[model samples]
Target: NAGVTQTPKFRILKIGQSMTLQCTQDMNHNYMYWYRQDPGMGLKLIYYSVGAGITDKGEVPNGYNVSRSTTEDFPLRLELAAPSQTSVYFCASSWRATNEKLFFGSGTQLSVL
Candidate 1:
């Protein structure tokens, strides 16, 4: 609901494997964000885009990347999956700024072994 949809709600990845976590919103929001939450930890920002073609790194971007080719799509890419990268990933979108209320996807649970 809320226009945010995340794919592959559950996934298992082998060490050194890679995948792209897809997120999309139909609300036409200009600001989209990617965040990851490790077990027992708060959500950590991974990447965000103010709009299509404008992307930027966030707090924990070292092992991840993202792209926004359209206002409705923002996908996070993990080039090399690792145990340390296993976590619940969330995608959110807002109409304006980060301080505003955001619509978040159900979440993607990823495990690396």
Candidate 2:
């Protein structure tokens, strides 16, 4: 089974364009998260979900949104993309939120100009 999958490995958008980065896992994980990595920075949390119908904002939640309607999918939405939002997006899943290791997707590289 695919542990985690993210579509459109690479995408380029003009300023103000919108897109959704899809993420899915077949591991039945309870915790799902979205993170963005900049050129020289560590992963920054964008949003997360503890379970279906439960989602919370992370360190940087502005310009993004997420929904957890099932244990298998947590999609990140960018309503109006900006150059500042361009980064490598990673989706991760873990059985537990405390100490469990996260299984990450390949990542989606987004560029907004």
Candidate 3:
């Protein structure tokens, strides 16, 4: 969606490599989140930032990192890619945690070999 954008819709990574999943939103939402979904699984929060310069870990944070230097940008970083890390990543933003009017990116599919 235009409101939330995620680059590199699909990716293949070698084990031990690193990459950053870019997510940007034009909605100016205060709360942004990074979620991962494995096959047949619901979205699992990897990280979230309430505002710029403030971030915290979520349900799944191992092998991943995130930073919110600006309200429009929240990038998720995989320091060391692994097989288990391969999944579909979705970036979403909401004015609050109430899930009202939450906007989501198309999603990025990552495969690790």
Q: Name the top TM-score candidate.
A: 2
Looking at model 3, report the run of 10 residues with the lowest lDDT sum.
95-104
Task: Name the lDDT value of residue 13 in candidate 2.
Answer: 94
List lDDT for all candidates, in order: 0.94, 0.95, 0.94
Best by lDDT: 2
Question: Which residue runs of candidate 3 sit more than 4 Å off their true CA positions?
Answer: none
lDDT of 3 at 70: 100
Reference-based lDDT, residue 102, model 1: 94
Off by over 4 Å in 2: none
Candidate 1 lDDT, 26-63, residue by residue in tens: 99999999999887889999999999999999999998
Judged by lDDT against the true structure, how good is candidate 1? 0.94
TM-score, candidate 3, is 0.96
Candidate 3: global Cα-lDDT?
0.94
Model 3, 1-108: lDDT tens per residue? 479999989999999999999999998899999999999999999999999999999999999999999999999999889999999999999996636777889999
* TM-score per candidate, chains pooled: 0.97, 0.97, 0.96
Worst 10 residues of 1 by lDDT: 1-10
* Candidate 2 lDDT (Cα, 0 to 1): 0.95
